[model samples]
Target: MTPLPIAAPLTIAIDGPAAAGKGTLAKRLAAHYGLPYLDTGLLYRAVGRLADEQGVDLDDAEAAGAVARALDAGAIDEAALRGREAGELASRVAAHPPVRAALEAFQRAFAADPRGAVLDGRDIGTVICPGARVKIFVTASAEVRARRRTDELAAKGRTVEYERILAEVRERDARDAGRAAAPLKPAADARLLDTSELDIETAFRAACAIVDQAPH
Candidate 1:
């Protein structure tokens, strides 16, 4: 892979809510900069999946925290996590303060790696990497986001009603934004990218430009 053109190693934190195109932008930025990308959402999904596997109640804060604390990145199955149920469960688990705290060290270590890294999630900038050299908050209209998600799921042969998906998206936004721990708001220093009208490539280019111009 070509190396990311950077004066020195640093973390790039991308934060946004569901279906906001933050994931796509982060992945492309990582590739362009030759950095490893971490979908921080995956960590929550791992905890939620593990908790469900062990028959723990979704609201059991202590058990959820313990599961998150012991989560091993090696155990995560990205494909399996794409399930709608898993995502909903993950969001619920992620609202737990302990669960978010438990994963902070892992995220910090990844950010401080010599090779550099890019992380994307609901709070990557607000909490996970507040000091990150480049912080991007990607966002889109609720309707547009829901439509994109519906299309993606349909392409994968996963049947889901569009209105149901839109409702879920709105519900998730509310939960994330209302959470007590590291709520889903852009960091003060972050550059907000509203991709409501832009395509993936265009949004990515805009994100990369922000990263390129940010002071290290």
Candidate 2:
């Protein structure tokens, strides 16, 4: 039996580990193509923030899953989840199978919209939007990503040590790659972009080329 085709519009999935520039590229791609852009990590971040606000233990999978299920993106305060602490909590919550299951439907629904969308997350290409028109797995070395993250935090007036940030980045990478539920990896048909040496503009342009060249 043949699977039914995905609905119209070009859904783009950009995935990567922490600070790999996937978010930046996704935003640019969405803007260029006038599609809705979603940084799916924000979904988990919102959940983590809820767990923290409600004093739930990060290790309690049931609690985390509950928060994920009740997450209201419209009500989430992105500014509240912008710190390093929120990111760490998000990583822990994201490992819970139930939490991932809870969020998967929301992600799939957004990707299925006919108006088109660009979503960036660890599992976007592999899980959320496998049939997307273009899938890009954007990544860079941990050192490079850490440096980028450090600069970003500094610009945002957040104080964080580079060594500490780097350690956290590597730890998160291990956790994401080793997790049993939707482990972070590129999709079979996804294009890989190593932005270790490329600037944001260059990386965006490279991604644009990939999207432009993909057969509609």
For residues 1-216, write the lDDT of model 2, one tens digit per residue. Answer: 999786468899998998888888999999999999888999999998889889998888898899898888788787778777888888999999989999999899989878989999999988888889899999999999899889989998988899988999999999999999999999999999999999889998999999989877
How badly does each model clash, as a count of residue pairs? 1, 0
Residue-level error in angstroms, candidate 1, position 81: 1.1
Give RMSD to native, each candidate: 4.2, 3.4
After TM-score superposition, the amount by which residue 173's alpha carbon in candidate 1 deviates from its true location, in angstroms, is 0.3
The residue-by-residue lDDT of candidate 1 on 101-159, one tens digit each, is 89989988888888779999988887878888899999999999999989999999988
Cα RMSD of predicted structure 1: 4.2
List where candidate 1 sits over 4 angstroms from the true fold.
Answer: 1-8
Clash pairs of candidate 1? 4-33
TM-score of each: 0.93, 0.93
TM-score of 2: 0.93
